[model samples]
Target: MTISNDLFTRAQELIPGGVNSPVRAFRSVGGAPFFTKKAEGATLTTADDKELIDFVCTWGPAIHGHNHPVIRDAIAEALNNGTSFGTPNPYEVEMAELIIKMVPSVEKVRMVNSGTEATMTAIRLARGYTKRNKIIKFAGCYHGHVDSLLIAAGSGALTLGKPDSAGIPEKLAEETIVLPFNDLSKVEEAFSNFGDQIAGIILEPFPANVGLIFPTDGYLQGLRDLCTKHGSVLIFDEVMTGFRVSAGGVQEHVGITPDITTLGKIIGGGLPVGALGGKAEIMDHLAPLGPVYQAGTLSGNPLAMAAGIASLKLLLEGDAYSRLDKMGKQIASAIASTASEIGLPLQVPQVGSMFCVYFSEKRVDTLDDATATDTDRFNKYFHTCLEKGVYLPPSKYEANFISTAHEQGAIDRASEILCETLREL
Candidate 1:
């Protein structure tokens, strides 16, 4: 009956902590992670035969929900043609064009396998083009596990990143200056101290990795202006927010364009795809054009491209974003009202379809505020929701997602469960 325990017993012998990813171990919550067998629409059928209303949505890729027929059919059609060619394909060009059209700031784009690769390539391209060595990243804004960007990694690595990973050299960490999120004074000070040597400033414009923290008014524009003044590249790591926040991502929503933007999640349509895009002049710095070398055998894989095209097509079909905004507001309001009724200290930060429920009395505006949350209370809430057949992101530091598949019924049920859970807690 305990499927997660059995799977963990077997997986630990093969994979580290019984998961390819660290957070799946359920370490923060102190429980066995459910082994998912199948998923359809907004629900995940676990190996134990439990059907849960999935809110994590595979950590943001299943924006249209799991096993979407259009995306699946596209992948199947691609599989019939061939798998990998390790060469150019028409789908690659189509995917690139779709990205260029959808994201306003991505004038040119290069594909890779994961967000880590996209960010790594973006940083490399900035360094190559600017001929500078230093980079700036904000605390608790995770841009994947890339060595140079690990100074204050969030999500799964947040608790263990005090020393910035075991293998990353101190010299590499020294090159990265980690500052507070949403703090313009710290950003200005960093630039003032090392503006000449800094190649780029990279951050998650919304800071979703440590929960959904929004930028202060004019904060993103300030970054753009500062980067322009200092002759440094501004890279918005929108792996989580790219397509989820709006059709054009956070950059368009905020009316500020970064020099580079890293995308993943919804753009890939639940596939393993990532891209870094920016001005053609800077993108040309990559290999086959300039000296910055970046290559991926599976970059622009046909199946991924097919699924992405299908997903993007579906997203472009109607006023889907307006629907997403409505859903986000509905769920956020429901949860907030319930929390207030129960006198539970909670803060729900939401943007579009992504949100995080922080078990804190104070408003969460920065990474420090996020860390101050009562994670112990969150673990209790998570287990309670899980027992009620609702699945949320396992860690308090992560965001919960809603997909097009989630209807009012699911949202209401989830809100009721959360309310009961908080009351019990």
Candidate 2:
């Protein structure tokens, strides 16, 4: 057996599904997951000593690419100052300031340990601020595994949401009104029915979890208007898209401002970190400022903060975002056109540095449309790409990411490998 296979065998005995995260188990793509011993630039060197071009980018955090010297040096410098303080630190304050400056909707920000904590806190703050219980989320937009958000939409907007996972109380699910993405009429109906009870509407401005789908034109502004009309907070869950899509994420790119924003991934600089920020009024509702209670012992680890600051600063340096965009377009456009030419029923939806390959004839915009894509074909393509040294996101449902590090010849090679696979398919 290979070293990675041996490690997986050992891990399965000690950990659930032999992986800490479900997707990392490679259940959807049909293979044993390779354990990476090291990463640099846009590639992962596996335990089996194989090098593969990585498009996952550590699941959206490594925007500057893995093990960049700047981030590494920052982390090293911070380590000399000691690790945890359990009290307020300068890093947290600076990180907060940087977030406010970049994300247009974030006027005040609080650091959290994980995207789940950030999202959970955002939900509670919204409810506490509005003094209402209901939260409206879209079906395919994942905002962590918070109980209220772990819901699937019912038959219609007026229907109560159903639990998408086990162990979640049915009553808690009802507090969330899950609706189909890209449909504003359903949102209007929900608000019309529960206008008085809705605390806020939270959605991924770009639904990255379900194949990186973009909002239909005017869909975001429509939601913003409804929230304004109903006095409900509008929350943008930009955990996946935040720093990866652009400095201000979808809000800046599309010119729509939300009342609250949850962020993670790139902001953490490949470390465990998350944050929530919004209008000062709504944010003031938390803890020492107001009634909503949220606390994290390691909210802003000094090491993570220093590394994150370096990552964000790197984005502003020269042409990182532009280069990433160029890489995204180079690979996405090439593969998509090839799929079309070969008569493969495929759709590759991409934006900025994020993209996805959906084996579907129809364009994917809704949860139903995304689910209907042919996973079998995608699984074959995924394994083939892996064999040829390109590592994409393991599932058809997850979006792939590129990094500034990909600008140096990686983009062209990835495009060639992907097109070759499409032709083979």
Candidate 3:
């Protein structure tokens, strides 16, 4: 048996589902998940000693690729000082300052340990600020497994076919109004029906968790306007898109401001980090300034702050986003052109370095369309590509990421492998 198979056998005894995360179990892909021994530049060395050209990019944080020297050095430097202080540190202040400077809508920012924490706090803060109980979330937008946000969520929850997790109170779920993404009319209807009760509306602006669906034309702006008209807070869940899509994120790219923005992934530079930022008036509603209680001892740990600063600085150094976009187009176009040549029904939705391949001919713009993607074919394609030394997200309902380390050669090689795999299938 392969080392990964052996490892899985042992892991299942100790860890639930043989993995820390649900998708890592490879249940959707029908295979043993390979554990990574090490990673560098756009590749992961599997436990079986195979080097796979990684397209998962550690689920959207490896913008500079794994084990980047710059980030490593920053972490090492921070380590020299200390790991955790429990008291406020300089790195936290600097990190918050950097976020305020970069994200246009974020005037004040607070750090947390994970995207879940950031999002959960944002919800509470919004409710506290608006003095309302209900929150509106898109059907497939995963806001980090917060109880109320778990209904009709995406990511592993979608992959496992359990959008609504068990053990969450029914009343909590009811307070979260799940709506179809990219549909402004439904949003308007929700507001008209429960305008005074809506504390906020949280969305992934681009909805990367459910396979990278984009907003319809003027759809985001329409949400902004509706939120304003209803006196509800607008929360952009950029945990996946922030800093990775652009320096200032989708808000900066699209020019629509949000009252609160939740960020993680690249902002932490592959470390466990998350942040919530917004207009000072709303942010001040959090504890110490207002009634919303949110606190984390490990929040803004020195190592994460240092790593994030290095990652953001590197992104700012050159035309990184442009380069990433160019590379993204190369991979995306290759997949599209090949699928067309082979008469395969494929739709590749891409923005900046994030994209997903839907094995359907129809354009995917809503959660319904993304949910209708062909998983059987995607599983077959995933295994074939992995056998050929290319690794993508294990499930069809996840976004594939590209890193700065993925140059033209890697892109070309991955494209060829993807095309050949498609042709064979």
Candidate 4:
């Protein structure tokens, strides 16, 4: 009597792969995905009426936990005012002001419907401002589904890019240069060959797409310096790390500010929202101020703005981030210790409330390193934890998130289950 299985059967008839998002299909972990009926605090009640301690946190937006009273109340209140006015709203202005005040790099911000919209718009603005067609991005850093950025490496180190997806023209991909993560030398080489034509370099400061990989010492600072030296904008795609890593995002943590920043996830307060912000000079290249054009009918939806304000206001109060760091360290240390005791090859990388467990003997510093992890072992562990009432991210490539609502007791229970699972493995 698995409700999730029944629903999944029905979903397959209505949606592609029985899921809207590919990751949600549980293809990586090899199982039918859990259909959650409700979520509160730090737990999710699946359609089968099973309660599990949630670690994904809705892919890093549930910092205050799912259905937080403040955010829910705000959404309910906004519903009374109606949805989608298709015009300027005061809530949008308030959300923008909060972002500018909190993020050191964002002087002004424009709202879009999703992270993809934000990254796409930021790249277009960069090209328009610098009058350059080429852009540089690191491998495994997913900015969105932009065609120009959808490129894989060619045969050699210095070779140009090839289309990772069909329909992306080779000419469009040529404008994008792909490089290895944390390799400053490759970045230099790309700039050496096409620096003048390179409009900007975009990347995730703390990449979470392929597990949690932090930038090497001075890696981010080097990018900032290089972009400044080359007169090209540096765009930090903080869509995943935005408020999850720290209140000011990873830019604040690293002390290296980018010329432009793209944000999503927590900023939307669990709704569909994305933003691109930066120095006035670059942002002015968008819309009425410059030739670059970007528009969205539901860009700054009032409901999303209200929820965002509520969430940020809560984060701004007192020591939320400190608590999050404490919790993150506790979980990482516990899992690491357990893996060691059970003779499991585990590499746990953590920052603030985000963490990832890579089942590999080698340290995971890049996508290539992360890919080397034993997925078969992880798949076994994933199901084991799921049976023990602990919910983790389905893919090894995705990071686990903790919320302010996750208590010490929940962590202890999850850690004990993980330890037992490792021993069994």
All predictions: root-mean-square deviation over Cα?
Answer: 1.2, 3.2, 0.8, 3.3
Assess candidate 4 and give its TM-score to the true structure.
Answer: 0.96
lDDT for each residue of candidate 2 in 1-425, tens digit (9 for 90 to 100) = 99999999999999988987777888777779999999999989999999999999988999988999999999999999999888888988889989999999998999998988999999999999999999999987888778888776211111112327678888898899989999999999999899999999999999887777888988999999999999999999999899777899999999999999999988888899999999998889899989999988898999889989989999988888888888888888998889878888878888889988888888888988977888789889999999999998877778899988886678888888989988988
Can you write out model 1's per-residue Cα lDDT over 326-362, one digit (the tens) per residue? Answer: 8888878888988898888989998888888998998
Best-fitting candidate, measured by TM-score?
3
lDDT-based ranking, best first? 3, 1, 2, 4
Segments in model 3 whose C-alpha atoms lie over 4 Å from true places: none
Of 1 and 2, the candidate ahead on TM-score is 1
Name the candidate, 3 or 4, with the larger TM-score value: 3
Off by over 4 Å in 2: 153-163
Count clashes in each candidate, considering only residues at least 3 apart in sequence or on different chains. Answer: 0, 0, 0, 0
Residue 71 displacement in candidate 1 (angstroms): 0.3
Give the distance in Å from residue 217's predicted Cα in candidate 1 to where it truly belongs.
1.8
How well is each residue in 366-414 modelled by candidate 4, as lDDT tens digits? 7678767898998999999999999988887778999988888998888
Error of 2 at 82 (Å): 0.3
Name the TM-score of candidate 1.
0.98
Against the true structure, candidate 1 has what lDDT?
0.89
**Mind giving the per-residue lDDT tens digits that candidate 3 earns over 1-425?**
99999999999999999999999988888988999999999999998899999999999999999999999999999999998999999998899988999999999999999999999999999999999999999988999979999999999998898989999999888899999998888999988899999999999998988888888899999999998988999999999999978899999999999999999988788889999999999999888899999998999999999999999999999899999999888889999999998899999988899888999979998778887888889999999999999999999889999999997889999999998999998
lDDT of each: 0.89, 0.87, 0.92, 0.87
lDDT of 3 at 270: 85
Better of 1 and 4 by lDDT: 1
